[model samples]
Target: MFFEILKNLRKKFKRLYITMFKNYIIFVFLMLLVLSGTIGFMIFSIGKMVSSEDYIKDTQKFFMASKIVKSDYKKIDASKIVASKGWVEILNSNKKVIYVIGTKKDKVTSYTENELLNFMDLSYNNLKSGTSYFYSVTAFNSNGEDLYCIVKVPPGIVTLNVDIAPSPDKYIKKAAIYILVGIFIIIVFLTVSVFLYAYLTTKKVVMPLKKILQGIKRMTEEDYSTRINFNAENKFGEIRDAFNFMAEKIEASIFERNRMENLKQQLLSDISHDLKTPLTSIMGYSKALNDGVVENDKKIKQYLNIIYNKSKRTVSLIENLHEFTKLDNSKFLISKEECDFCEFVREIVSEYYNEFEEKNFELEINLPEDEIIYEFDKVEMERAISNIISNILKYNEVGTKAKIELTYDNSKIQLIIADDGVGIDESLKENIFEPFVRGDKSRYTKGGTGLGLSIANKIVQKHGGTLTLEKCKKYKTVFRLKL
Candidate 1:
C-alpha cells in the first residue's frame, strides 16, 4: 500500500510537472499576481485601520467647543429657539460654514449645518413631548454666509450661537476620494509593473530554457543530429551547464548502446555470411552429385540424395539466419521513388498471391482507387510487409484469416494488417515485438528470429511513419501503420 501510494504520488507529480511547470512564464505570471494582490490588500487594510470617522461624538464635541463661546455650561437662555434670522446671536451672526462653537463643554463641537439639521430633528423629536424646557444651539461667524448649526432649548426656547471655521471633514472626504483614486492608479500600475517585472525576469530564464528543453526532447526522440546552443553567464548559465551535461550524458549513452548493438549485429552478419557461402557451395556440390553424377548406383545414389537433401535443409536454415541477421544490421538504406501508393500495393499483392495461398492463409485486401502519390522505397516496404506476412503464416493455425487495408484521408496514409491467430498472452504482450521474442516459445517450427518486427518498425520510422500493434487477443492480432 505504501509503495502504491508513492507510485501514485510520483505519477501525479510527473503529470503536473509536464502540464504545468513545463512553461516557466506561467509560473512567473502567477507569482506577480500573488505578490501584487498581497501588497494591495496590505495597503488597503492599513488605510482602513488609520481612517478617521467623519462625524462621531469626538468630532461633534470639537466643533461645538470651537464654535459656541460664552454659552458653555452657563445659565440656560430661553424664548429664542425659532425667531429665525440669527435669533441666537442676533445680528452678530457672520461665520460662513461654522464648524465648532466656543461652548464650555465639548458636547457638540464638530456640528456642521447639514449635521445640524439632523441634530435639530432629533432634539425636536424629544421636545415634541411638550417638555417643560430644552436647549438648542446655532452657529455663525463675524460675516456668516455659507454654513452654521442652530440648536434650540425648546419650551424654554433658548438658542445658542457658535463661531468657528468649518472642520476639515469636507476636505478630508475629498482627500479620501483622491487617495482612493490614487491607490487605484497605483494598483493598476503595480499590477502592470509586477507582470512586466515577471516577464522581464522570466524571459531571461524561460525562453532559453524552453529552447533547450525542445532541443533535448527532439534528441531523445532519436534526432541525435539536432544541435542546440543556449549560452548564458549567470544562473541560467549554470542551468545551461546542467542541461548540456544531461544532454551529453544521454547522447553518449545512446551512442554507446547503439554502437554496441550494431557491433553485435555486425558480428552476427559476418558469421552468417561466412557460414552461408560455404553451405551454399556444399549444397551445390551435393545437388550436382545426386542429380547428374550418381544416376544408377542405388546405395551411392541414395547416400548422395540424402546428402543433397540435408545440405539443402542446412542451406535454407543458414539463409534464414542470415536474413534475420541482416534485419539486425539494418545498414541498408532505401532508394526512394515517388509512386502511386495504391498502385504499388496492388502490384505487390498481385505478385505474392501464390505465397499466401500456399500457407492456406485466407487473404483479404483493400485499397483506395484514388491516385495518391508518396515517396517510398519499394524494397524497404516489401521487406517490412513480407516479414509481417511471414509472421502471420508461421504463427497462425491452418486456414487462419488475414487482412491488408490501405486508407488515406487528410493527406495521411494508413496501412492496417490484421490476422486471426493465437494472439499474445496478456502478460507478455508488451515485449512480444522485441528482438528475438516469439509469439510461441514452446516450439521452434516458425524459426521465429525476433528481428522481423523490430526491423519493420525501423523501416516504417525511416519512412516518417509509425508502426503500432493495434490489438492482440486470443483470436487475432492487428498491426497499424500510420503516415
Candidate 2:
C-alpha cells in the first residue's frame, strides 16, 4: 500500500521529479569527488609528515636508548646517546652528574634532589644556555647499582614521552595500504551510484521523446488527426498542447477542402443537366420544322414559338450562370449610393404589382412612412429583391398571398419577403441558398435554372448585407434581408 501511494505521487509530479533528481545526482557526484580528493590529500600530507627522515630517525634513536637503559645502564654508549645538536647525561643515586657527552652548556655538575626531580618531571627551558630541551629519563639497576640516564634533545630535533614503532618504514607501508583500500571502496560505490542515476534520468527523458516522435511520424503519413497526449509540467506540456492545436486546424482544413471539391463536382453535374434539357428541346423542334413534319400553318407557328421559347430559356440559364460567376469573382465591387430605402422598396414592389395582378396573386406591402435612408447599389439591390418575388410567384398557386415588409433602425435595415404557399422542402432548408439546390423534383419540370436564390445571396453579400431564409409564424416561407 505504501509503495502504491509513492508511485502515484511520482507519476503526478514526474517532470519535477526528473529535474530535481538530475540535479541531485550531479550534486552527489561532485561531493563525492571533492570528498575523495580531500581524503587523499589529508592522507598524503600525514604520510609526508610522519615518514620524514628526521622524525623517523628521532623515533628510532629514542627507542634504542630506552632498550639499552632498561637492560644495562653501564652498556650505554655516549657517542650514540646525543642527537646532532643535543646532549646526554648520567647521574648517580646521589643526584649528581657523573658522566656527560656532547655539548653540555649547563654549568651545574652537582644537583639537589629537588633540582634533579624537576629535570625529570618537566621539559626544562634553561635560561643560561638559552636552549629548550625535551627530556626522557630511564632508571635502571646494574648489579644492584642505581643510576639514571637522561636523553635530552632540542625541541626541534626530536619528540619525547610518546610511544612509536621501531620500524618507521613498515608502519608507513601498512598505513598506506589501508588508505588505498578505503579510497578504492569509495570510488567503486560512487561509480555504481552514478551509473544508476544516469540510467534512471535517461529513461525519464527518452520515454516522452519517443511518444512525440511517434506522433510526428503518424502526421507525416498524412494522419492530420494525430495528437500527442503528454502530461508534464515542463516544456513537454507546452509541446503537447501546441501539437493538438495544430492537428485540429489541419483536420478542419482537410475537411473543408474535401467539401469544396465535392461541391464543385455537383455544380458541374447540375449545370450540364439544366443546359442539356433546353438545348435538346430546341434541337427537336427545329429539326421537326426542317424535316417538314408539321404541315398546318398554325401548328408550324406553334412549333416555331416552342423553339424560340426553349432557346430563350437556355440563354437565360447561361446569363444567370454568368452573373453568378461574376459575383463570385474576388475583384467584383458594387457601386453604392445613398437613397431612401423605403421609396426604393416601394418602386420595386410597384413594378411587380402588374405581374401579381395578372397572376391573380394576393399582394401585401408594409413600408414605413418615414424615409429610411441607406447606401446600396440600386441595380444589384433591385435584382436581389426581384429574384425573391419571382421565386415566390414561380412556386406558388395563383391565389397565394405574397407580402413585403421593410423595417430599419439606426444600425441596420431589414427587408422581409413572405408568402402563404407550398413551403420549401425540409431537406433543402439547410442549403437553400447554395447554387443548384431546388425545392423538389418538380423544380426541374417547372423550368428553373436553380440559381435565383444563390444569385440573390451573392448580390446581398457583395453589398455587405446578409440574405437568409427564416421561420415566421404567419407565413409558410420567409426570406429576410439585412443591410
Best by TM-score: 2
Evaluated at residue 400, the lDDT of candidate 2 is 89
Error of 1 at 262 (Å): 12
Q: What is the C-alpha lDDT of each candidate?
A: 0.60, 0.77
Tell me the TM-score of each prediction against the true structure. Answer: 0.44, 0.56
Candidate 2 lowest-lDDT run of ten: 122-131
Q: Candidate 1, which segments miss by more than 4 Å at Cα?
A: 1-332, 424-428, 446-448, 472-475
What would the per-residue lDDT of candidate 2 be over residues 336-438, giving only the tens digit for each residue?
9999999999998988888899889888888999988888999988888998998888888889888899988877999999998988988898899888888
> What TM-score, to 2 decimals, does candidate 1 have?
0.44
lDDT of 1 by residue, 1-483 (tens): 323533544564466456545556666676577657766775665465446453332234322322343333232231222232112322123333233222322233344445455544553335344543343444433332333444333343232222112255664676566567656766787688779767865676567667766875786586755555666665455545655565676678889899779857865774565456546766765766757765657856676666666566556555655655565565856679998988887886777688788878888889888887999988888778777877777777778788988999999999888888777666656765555555676424344545677677777877889888867553368888887
Off by over 4 Å in 2: 1-214, 227-242
Task: Give the candidate number with the greatest lDDT.
Answer: 2
How well does candidate 2 score on lDDT at residue 237?
Answer: 70
